[model samples]
Target: MSSTDHAAAVHQVHRDDYGSRLGMWLFLFTELILFGGLFIVYAVYRFMHQQEFHLAAQELNTTIGLINTIALLTSSMTAAMSITAMQKGNLRFSKWLIWVTIGFAFVFMVNKYFEWSAKIHHGIFPGSKDLLAKPDGEILYFGLYYVMTGLHTFHVIVGVIFFLFILRQIKQGKITSDRYVRLENSALYWHLVDLIWIFLFPLFYLIH
Candidate 1:
């Protein structure tokens, strides 16, 4: 082998513990920036139509939003605890906790589906005749509401899939106490999903 090629191969043989985490963080940063842009747009529109925005937000059911907020928060706690359980070599408990987290995720989605269904039933969806007839500010409010919440719902589904993958790894003994970055990263992603909803509930359901 060429000496330069051999040297490169040797360098690649070393495992960098922080490298996986660093990559995950970088990916998360990009996600945050993407959401940040949406936040800016929402802010600008809200400022332009404060009263209408307030009125529009009132149509959302704060009760359901509150329930979802609690569910996501509890799910985050369970996910974090699962990682701890794994680190302590309690694979069975860790698996059980993750399953609970998945259950919470399902609850969140079901709540969201009902909420969206009710709004659509009431002709509150974007471009609906009711919405189109409203003032520009209210229209924008519902529009942003659908877009942001829809995206967040998509994330919740993705997070569920992510946890399922983690559970599979645990079952196969691929994720162990010493090598649990996959689970840790999934937990981080789930937390991000929860955090986004923290803002969303206030903006869309409670501000009125």
Candidate 2:
């Protein structure tokens, strides 16, 4: 290829990389705004119903919450390490780390499933007869709890799917040491998932 043509191609690759990163950042920003608004609503309601919110929080199993928190934090670490491994040209190890991260996500979902099952079994779910009989603050607390955590859980599922797709790309040699922006972006997304859970853990489980 001509030198001028080669230089233009390289510039295009760089531009694409920059554009991908910028796009991911913009998406994350929108996510932040969504959860930020929910947080503000939570804060306002908690302020208005401090006692009931505190009491409702007591119904949550802190132990299970702690376990899920640890799982996500560890998954975040694994996701980041996967990117580093790919950048370092350790494809096999990077793939292994991605699998590990997905495993952690599974653990989180399992725990959440059981937790929700327990709540539902106890008739504490939104709009249930038992929940409807509770004080308004307690009702609101569980409502927010279900909505926020459910949304975060959905994000976890999406992150798992993202990693699986990245794994496929790695296997096909599309994402390699020199071209791992997809992996990097997925890790950024996983970190956001973990960070949201960080806020949620304290808000829903530690309100004593």
lDDT of each: 0.92, 0.95
lDDT of 2 by residue, 1-208 (tens): 9999999888874437788988999999999999999999999999999999999999999999999999999999999999889888999999999999999999999999999999999999989999999999999999999999999999999999999999999989999998998998999999999999999999999999
lDDT of 1 by residue, 1-208 (tens): 9999999998885666588878888998998998889999999999999999998888989899999999999999999999999999999999999999999999999999999999999999977998899999999988999999999999999999999999999889889998899999999999999989999889888885
Q: Output the lDDT of residue 136, model 2.
A: 96
Q: All candidates' TM-scores?
A: 0.93, 0.94
Minimal lDDT window, size 10, model 1: 12-21
| Regions more than 4 Å wrong, model 2 | 1-15
Error of 1 at 177 (Å): 1.3
Clashing pairs in 2: none
The prediction achieving the highest lDDT against the true structure is 2
